[model samples]
Target: MLFLTRDLFSKKLTILFLIILGTYGCKTKTSSEQTAEQAPALVKSPEFNADSAYQFVQKQVDFGPRVPNTAPHKACGNYLVSTLKKYGFSVVEQTFKDTTFDGTIINGRNIIGSFNTANAKRILLTSHWDSRPFSDQDSLVKNKPVMGANDGASGVGILLEIARVLSLQATKPDIGVDIIFFDVEDWGATEQDTSMLHSGFCLGSQYWAANKHIPNYTAYFGVLLDMVGAKGATFLKEGYSMQMAEDVVREVWTTASRIGYNNYFIDERGGSITDDHVPVNTVAHIPMIDIIHTKNSVVRTFFDQWHTADDTMEHIDPKTLKAVGQTLVQVLYQESANLAL
Candidate 1:
């Protein structure tokens, strides 16, 4: 997740009356009538295993800091590819050399796994796999590498658990699902570095958005998970998500609310962030929304441990992972049923 250094400033709220209208614009049918017409067989989403997700997070952290140009990074990349293949997914790795903010070029890889590859309707779920290079936000050790347990590994861990369930299913969903682990997303310069480089952060996403793995890949929508494992983490509607993909945001948030995760998925608007979803929305033209933790009451940006060395396994909460993972499974299962017709 990107940090917002400036003070909290509000932008003019874009009235999303159209979305509200469309959402409520059912053909003038009464509530009971609509319920009768729409209520049908509901697919039960499989339970998401929090223990397995936590183990995945721990496995990544055990690799030490997954910073680029490091042995841990390379090993973790290989492990991720092999793990997805073992889960019965069709895996593809996109490797490239990315130039960082400090003029250092490092090898990066974007690992993708597809389920039900023959389906035309698709949903893209993504998270960054690389840990930050420096603990710039740490008060005591400001220059050390971070473990990125919550920031990077947590999201991928949840997705990996989802992949495991998808692999074991007897009847696969009709819609295709792609899980993308983007690299070089955490190599951005510190806030102290005042360089004018706009695309320094999220290098892997920028590359993948421009040169997609498939020739002309597209999805119905995309959901990006970031900083999701912290305890008491609240996910507000990010500004960029509200601007770019309001419908997707509503769908995910509404699902979260329905699943009793309303406390974690708040309804307030949050500051605009420059994370991996930016390139996917702008370059790829895929409506993508970021479900990220925000520090609203006290700190105005991300969680307190963000960018800090303390962002380790101790900061990750299994409850939070289960909440997010369960909600995502529900969303996918419901979307699959809708797309089947």
Candidate 2:
């Protein structure tokens, strides 16, 4: 939902600025040093149930597009809160009113579920829940609201499956885990709309970053998922994630590669996205990285069904979900074991 606007001259200037910053700020450690510090330790992660994840995605889409001010949106929110409560996590719902770019007042809710609540060391996982209001990118159905099976429900579904696994495990991690479902993230102005407002998207994340549920809250790191369930989705090292949390990004990409998912998790830089992670990194000072799908084509920068009514359950692939979910579980389990030592 992040948009960057610039003229041709300004685009060149921005590129120059990035090159200068990269030259001055970016540094790399030798492979030997990295290998010595981060030994090849095999950690067993929890079983990732792709079927469960797929069902979760379908459930949300069945409720129709979860656009703000709609009955479906309210129902899905309630369902998420109730489901998390059933999973034995301490749930907190942050509700607030936000004004969109075109001066539309809408209700937004950020649902957070905390595991091992007493532990101070923590990691935050998040995804947006609200579907895009307008399918402006669609050539034929430009006025329709997108179903957002991949955009909205896919990430949340993965997190929900993670929660289910964490709930059943006997030995919990020492560090707390927060699964956050942000709302009203896709209610921004369309590309055709000429309103030069940057703050339209990611409303719920901005609110949570400013008014954290826990006072003076901080986490060791955070990971965000977006458009992750598409078929043959490649998660390149997103530019914004590299800029914000290079260490975390490296850890995730390396873990994926070691776990035989290098084809999906490529070790190359993608475009700089302005997703929910941006607000968390900038305002809350949390080193957060986004695992999002990116394409190298002019047809659609995202997936084929992106922002289209055609984005349905058929596009949801269990293999992609398993790749992301299993990699994350491995990371968390390894981190927990290190903390125990």
Best candidate, TM-score-wise? Answer: 2
Q: TM-score for every candidate vs. truth? A: 0.87, 0.88
List model 1 lDDT by residue over 270-299, tens digit each: 888889999999999999999999856654
Q: What is the lDDT of residue 9 in candidate 1?
A: 22
What are the root-mean-square deviations of the candidates from the true structure over C-alphas?
A: 11.6, 12.2
- State residue 44's C-alpha deviation in candidate 1, in Å: 1.0
Model 1: lowest-lDDT 10 consecutive positions: 6-15
Q: Mind giving the per-residue lDDT tens digits that candidate 2 earns over 33-88?
A: 67546765866777989999999999999999999889999999999998888889
Clashing pairs for model 2 are none
TM value for model 2: 0.88
Compared with the true structure, model 1 gives a TM-score of 0.87
lDDT over C-alpha atoms for residue 292 of model 2: 96
Model 2 RMSD in Å is 12.2
